[model samples]
Target: MRKLTIVAIAMMMIVLTACSEGNKNGQGAANDNGKAAAQGQDAKAGEAGSDAKQEPVTLKVLRAGITVTETEFNAYLADAIKEKYPHITLEWVEAPEDVEIEPLITQGTVPDIIIASTTAATSDYERLDLVEDLTPYIEKYGVDLNRLKPVVLDTIKTYSPEGKLSVLPLSLNLPVLFYNKEIFDKFGVSYPKDDQSTWDEVIELGKQVTKQDGGVDFIGFDVNGPRNISTGLDLNILDPATGKSTLTSNPGWLKVFNVLKKSYEVPNYIGADGRYQYANDDDIFFNEQNLGMLAFNLAHLIGPLEELRQQGIELDWDFAPFPNFTENLGTNRSANVHALLVTKTSKHKDEAFQVIANVLSDEVQEKLARTGRIPTIQNEELEKLYGADIPVLQGKKIENIFKTEPRKVIKPHEFESDVRKFVDGAAKRIALEGIDVNTAIREAEDNVNKELQTLQTTR
Candidate 1:
């Protein structure tokens, strides 16, 4: 997560099988970042003697899903890479939409790289050793590790090791506070300042405005997503000392979750049309004019703000952070980080490491910053491009969402599978059968621990 010199990065591109990418809207900008890269540092493209007179080599890459920039951006980046290094070619490996890409990775049939999403899914690839570790490559190429924000780098470390540096996050997700300003002003309540309000306060505010609107009602949050649910819990449960899970038994967490589940009673649960609701988070903030507050990631907030602006919605609204946990002040959950890693099993380790390092250079970062990605390189360029201000894409990184508890890579399916069953059964017995909350939680934890033990000890 540091910046490399333009020269070093170009050399890196020559050997790296794939470029680690994060939060790409489409393909062309992905490569456009390369243009700024070329300008930032003029260096050897790593065209060795034999390949000097020949064209640069072409490297094929695979992505987990189709990108918004797949058609235009991918081609542009490919062309940019080729132009930067005369002898290089860029080939793509696009799988069918329904295809499971990880199997190909395990079988060693995957492209030079994988642009994936979600830690749960990406960790699966790392555990399978399907991706390469890029740490050595970074050190070898003199990447400015200091430039990258410490927290972003820390997230990657939670799942892997410095020795392995298997995966690198290119962008990060910060969950922002979403408050309906019109509602706040209408009720003579002040909007949450920097998201300093507690969940209890938010719920109380929602309750006051939870009145019927021609039979349609409103509530506090719409966190129907399991991941969102997990993130809220992830932060509240975070143990700052070691970043372990300390929230399972915390009453603060229980109260928060209870409030979340209670929203279902107010027609604000956001069950079926979840994605649309997320996209319209700002619109809901403006339109409802009564719903107090909510929290979600950048895309969830900014995307909807733009949507509402275009539609001429004139309600007041803004984004901020979730209230800080006393023990983990300034800490929040960071999601969707992308990392560049060199495969331990690679035949061209030197070339791969160099190439991965090249992509992290300031030249490339400047271009990527335009596409809304936070650069790993800590340089004036990022500040100039992304701004010193944490533009409420979500709550400004309070303490630091990136600084989290170091968690070892748990097996991909283990926790979620058992968690799903335990949560379902527990919720059913409690919500339906009227079991106690603490008892249900204790049962769920036991079920999850059993699943974890099996996964760890199995093979």
Candidate 2:
């Protein structure tokens, strides 16, 4: 009986050992399966992250001036945008001469981005309430405002009373004194001191070169307009607070008008018919090669001049610093920056700002500078790249554009553009009708007050 009992105990021990081995094997299989599942999930997650991309978007861009073309957009800006975003496609909308912005707003086709002059930011966009404050986007996108030129930033801020930054400057339109070397040489007069002459000195030089030769009248000097002259003196046509014309009260306007008179009164500058002979549209200095000195916006002339050169129309021309006012020597003309603004109505505000930020990137700004657009960024190297692409600018006084610092910006009044016509008329009277500066200013003030009254009533 004892032997039988021992055999039974041994059988029970064998059964228990088999059950323990089976449990160990089952736990190993469960752990391997769990690890395999976790690995599979990690692999799937890695694939998703690799394939992720920004959603495709199309942004409408409106270019305000006549200078911006579709081809130039493609060449300078569009490719840079494509390379960075890849998902973004830009649609260029040119502003037509006859068509206005209000109609586009009514049609719900307002552009996502607006590229316009700083003047238009205050006069047109602000008046229409088309722009939005970009401060939030500027902060959210990590944009360093310190990267931009201080004058450019200050000019943009002046447009907004609340100090909202509504625009990002793309390039500058700083004034430059462009001269026809052929005109100076033909008259046997020395060239105006490069970037070192004040307005008074330049005017004196202009008088020396103003003469009749070969039955052609060579005018000594001319400006783009009286508005440009007034701008340099930091003269605003209307007071922002009073909404009244400053033409009569501000002594600066007197200086501005007198400068205009002196510039035109160069002996024999006016035609026999008593008309200002040089129309800017004909580019008298470049095409006619008769004007000795011209104070004009550098950006406006450089590209066109280069194109003329490419067409084999040669004029031995060079530029100097924009001649300064006697009281404001070494001071540049008022800040004139071409800027980009995101519209208030844009649905894709973030993306629009992203595009603008990209446009202001170092790579893009350098490329723009190489193509002859003055960068708004404060980089010495980028400034050196100005006009690098335009072969005609080689060895020319390209640095003269940056030699003078921009004057403090005078915030523009809404009636500034309307009032400019009266000031221009005043300048004409002084030059043509022999009116004194006070009389011209008084006449301009009277006309401007009446026009402002009419504008207020109509609005």
Candidate 3:
């Protein structure tokens, strides 16, 4: 009986041991299954992440008239774009002189982006319905429009009928009074105050410097054109409400004509044959080096001046704030913005806006400012950095360019370009033909009215 009981006990112990081994094996199998399931999930997640990566896209950028060369575009914008978004490729489409935007659209090749002047934005783009409102994209991207100068924003808004933010100003052209130091020194006339001179004061100073020296004629002052002088007065050529020329009624037009007429009336300014010898262009100031002072576009002159310096042709030159009308003291020329816009037909608007935002980034803006293009943003430090990269602009009083605030821009009429001819003619008749301001204004008004009527009939 004792032997049978021991045998039962041994059998029970063996059964218990087998049960313990089976439980351990089952737990190990469960753990292995859990690990395999986790690994499968991780692999699927990796595939999903790969699929979610952005596809590469090529965005075509049209250069309408902003003077951005391919090399400059690559250096200033394209490379930065690549670093930020490896997916986007910027293709620069340079519009030939004769190539119109309408033809490009009909060819099914509308560009994703356009770089153009503010004037072009108001006229060409508006006429063709090519601009896309960037307000929504600006919100989506958190683009800080507040960083830009208020005048620039105001000018851009004025161009739009509904005040939609269609374009972002990249840079602006501010007029500066460029003077030949040699001419001032020759006449023993004091240099024009950097930011304190008025148009009347400048004209009187021009009288001091206007003389024949060394058998060469030195004109006291000349403007690039009537347009340059008119900008400071915020003169609009046509009244938008009536679609008629404002030359006859706007008192500012009379001031503009008088200023030019006074400058040309300086002694020996008109040639012996009863013709105005000094042309209303930069050639007199830059090449001939005879004109004492020239009110011209600062942004447009930087490249040429830099090139001249590089070629070892240096001029004894300096610049002052653009002379203001006595009544409009402390008012600079109206903002002339060069803007970047996303086209209405663009499929990659988000990406295009990202590009614009990147360009307006502080780093890019600083770099561009160093190259002498005025930044649209209102950073004093950035403004101080102007012309830091150009050897010619070193030690120049570049600060004068920003002394006066830009005037609030008036929206130009569609006929503004057409009307400019009559205004120019009036100025020519007054300066060269010795016509009276009242008579010149009347002639300009009559001619512009006739032209507007013709344009209205044709359209």
Candidate 4:
């Protein structure tokens, strides 16, 4: 009996020893795996350090007018760029108001990045060989060209040779119709639909509201400024092909003039003195509250309307797609497209590209779009969130604002600034001075040609 008990105890001790060995083996395997993972992480960290040691660079960014700068870069963007490229510093430089950029080009001190409105001014930059073609960098950085608005992107590409991308669009300003709901209610006229209303329809609506009630003059429809009226007319004052004035050459010009002419002729639309009797064009929409409808870009209307609304000054206003000329229906006028261009003189072209890429990134675009700066990218998710940050657009009809695409003016004529002034002059003569359309167009053509000739000589 004693021998049997002793045999059982010995068997139990052997089993316990085997279990202890198994646990130690399992722990050894786990320690080996942990060491391998730590070594792999160290290798990755070393690779990242090697990449960072290449070089530190500071890019000079110059902007003309109210283009993007440090002031508008926002805190989120600044931190984002810093986190991505800690070695890169962006130096903001502004060209003096009186000094032309041509001198900078002549001095061989062109900035690494150029931000400006892609207009005739940018065309001049292209002519001077200052603007760099970014097709290669676009590919290098894997920029999703498909993400941008096709029409506006195409317009910017047209500014480059062989359809190369010259500028990265920062924002697009499309014309829109802003109307005072109070004026519509006061005049007993139904509000124009943002999506469906046409210029002709707006004209008819204007006739109803443009009348003196209790000796107070009310203008039915007026453009935000002379440029707004001219752009809505859709007349390309300069012909890119011929470099001549199209004010008289194109029949469309005559029709464009007539559209504005008919609007001004709406009974009591203008005062006997040929000026907005109650207020300037913008004030008429906000403070005076007498303007039934206003044709302007989002920039001109949204900010001011929001300011008024925040001040507790009630302005019953809503925006719609811009009214179009009968011939130019389904087309919205896009002007003052803000863009960023890399200069050929940039030493760190790759780093400069990253800056622009960051600009159009989802994070930055959402920020800009929320602040009422229209984004260049076409994002459906962002669309639903448009003006979400602005209190004034809380219940307004803003969907139509993005419904229509601006007509692509692929070949914008040169000397456009001069041509714009000439056309505006013609519009003034026809609408305010009662000058004949034919006579006004002919005079504008001759004046524009003379100005172009002088410009050619100076260049």
Q: Which TM-score value belongs to model 1?
A: 0.65
> CA lDDT, every prediction?
0.47, 0.72, 0.73, 0.67
RMSD of each: 9.2, 23.1, 23.0, 19.0
Residue 449 in model 2: lDDT: 91
Q: How many angstroms is residue 352 displaced in model 4 relative to the true structure, after the best TM-score fit?
A: 1.9
Q: Per-residue lDDT of 293-326 in model 4, one digit per residue for the tens?
A: 8776675566556656656887887877787766
Which candidate would rank higher by lDDT, 2 or 3? 3
lDDT per residue (tens digit) for residues 1-459 in model 1: 011122222323321222233224332232444445444333433423234355345565555532212332242245435444555444566654345855775687756655555363346666575666666555544455544566656556655633556665545545556677666565566666653545445545555655444654445555432334444345323343433333375565465446445543444433344421332344455554545666655433443343344456544666656543344445444444655444455555554444445555554555555433456654534534441212322233333222332222222232453345555555445434456667766776677666656755774
User: Predictions ranked by lDDT, top down?
Assistant: 3, 2, 4, 1
Compare the candidates by lDDT and give the number of the best one.
3
Cα lDDT tens digits for candidate 2, 153-229: 78888866476787888787777888888888887889877655777788889888889889988888876567776
Tell me the lDDT of candidate 4.
Answer: 0.67
The digit string of per-residue lDDT tens for model 3 on 237-304 reads: 89877787788788888888888788777777776776563535545666778888877777545665
Candidate 2 residues lying further than 4 Å off, grouped into runs, are: 1-53, 97-99, 161-163, 277-279
Model 2 accuracy (lDDT, Cα): 0.72
- Each candidate structure's count of clashing pairs: 39, 0, 0, 0
Task: Return the clash pairs for model 2, or none.
Answer: none
**Model 1 lDDT-worst window of ten:** 1-10
